[model samples]
Target: MIRLEALAKRFPPERQALQGIDLEIENNAWVLISGGSGCGKTTLLHLIMGLDQPSQGKVFLHHQHLGRLSAQARARLRANIGLIFQEPHLLQRRTLWENVAFPLELAGQFGRALRQRALESLEQLGLGARATALPAQLSSTERQLACVARALITGPSLILADEPLERLDPQNAALVTDLLRARHRAGGLTIVQTCSESPATLPDATARYTLCAGRLVPSGLLER
Candidate 1:
């Protein structure tokens, strides 16, 4: 479960990114956080992922406090959280295999074990044939698929994506969307996604929220 109670992230006098937002998302629930650019949608994800700090209020993951956790504890918390962005953001110098191995390597798993896990992720993304290819060699869509593969390789309990469909055709978009929905259906991950205005269909999001003027408001199911 993920809960944001009176959550706020203020920048300065000129910019109040998020203003006391309140939300509740149950386990295995798929949610969409829709908003205009810089409405604090991505900030919400960052705070949840422990990438940024909240100016005030509280963020809870399975009823665990986020702000008070130590750095090492936060790292452990992050291990169970996956994040995908607008682009793949792979290393230009590394091959697909090496890029996918990054997270596992960071976690201290190494050798053939790390290679095996990375290979499995590539296979899942249907990019195993291009495991030796560098990021420079892939199309934008393929790069994004690699990002998805890396995020899911750890079998995370929660997945957060920021504008996950920025550059893809309808066919490829649907394929990736279906992939996310399938993960949601497996009944363990709490998936939260942020997008500007989606193409009409989204992963079976159980709840939806709209962000405007720094406030996060529920949009509900029938609103779809």
Candidate 2:
């Protein structure tokens, strides 16, 4: 489970990014947090992912308090999570398959087995034909799809996606959304996706909330 208690964050010179946000998300649940830009949606996800510390209150992942963990420990915990940034962060020098195989390489896997696994991941995302291509050679949508493949290669229990659909066209957006929904239905994946769109846009979300001026407000789905 993931829990946030009175969570808050502040920037220099009196900028409050988040304030007194309280929330709880159970395992294997698909939750969507929707809001406009600068509403603290990204801030909340960063706190939950242990990438940043909360100024006040606490964030707990599976009962472990993130604020109390050392930076190294937080990084160790992060290895098990799948993270999809708003922008694709692929390596310009590497092939698509190589980029997808990165996490596996870090975990000490290599050679034929690693290459095969990476190929399979790309194939699942309909990027098999582009596996040998460089990030610079792919379209924006394909690059994002590659990012998704990389995130899922580790088969993480939790995925944190920030504004995933923000820049995609309709068909591509549906492709990404359908893939996430299929993974969730296949079981044991908990997804926390943030979007600058309405909750209704994500009909597959099991729970929904909105971030408004640094405050978290439960949507009708949550209230139900």
Structural similarity to truth (TM-score) of each candidate:
0.88, 0.93
State each model's C-alpha RMSD to the native: 2.4, 1.7
Which residue pairs clash within candidate 2?
Answer: none
Model 2 per-residue lDDT tens digits across residues 1-224: 89999999998889999999888998888888889888888889999999999999899997899999999999888888888988898999999999999988877899999999999999987899999999999998889988888988998899999988776788778888888888888889999999987646566677888888899887866432
Cα TM-score of candidate 1:
0.88
Cα deviation of 200, candidate 1, in Å: 3.0
Cα lDDT of candidate 1 equals 0.82
The regions of model 2 sitting more than 4 angstroms off are 199-201, 222-224
Candidate 1, residues 82-116, lDDT tens digits: the string is 87977679988989988888777777888998888
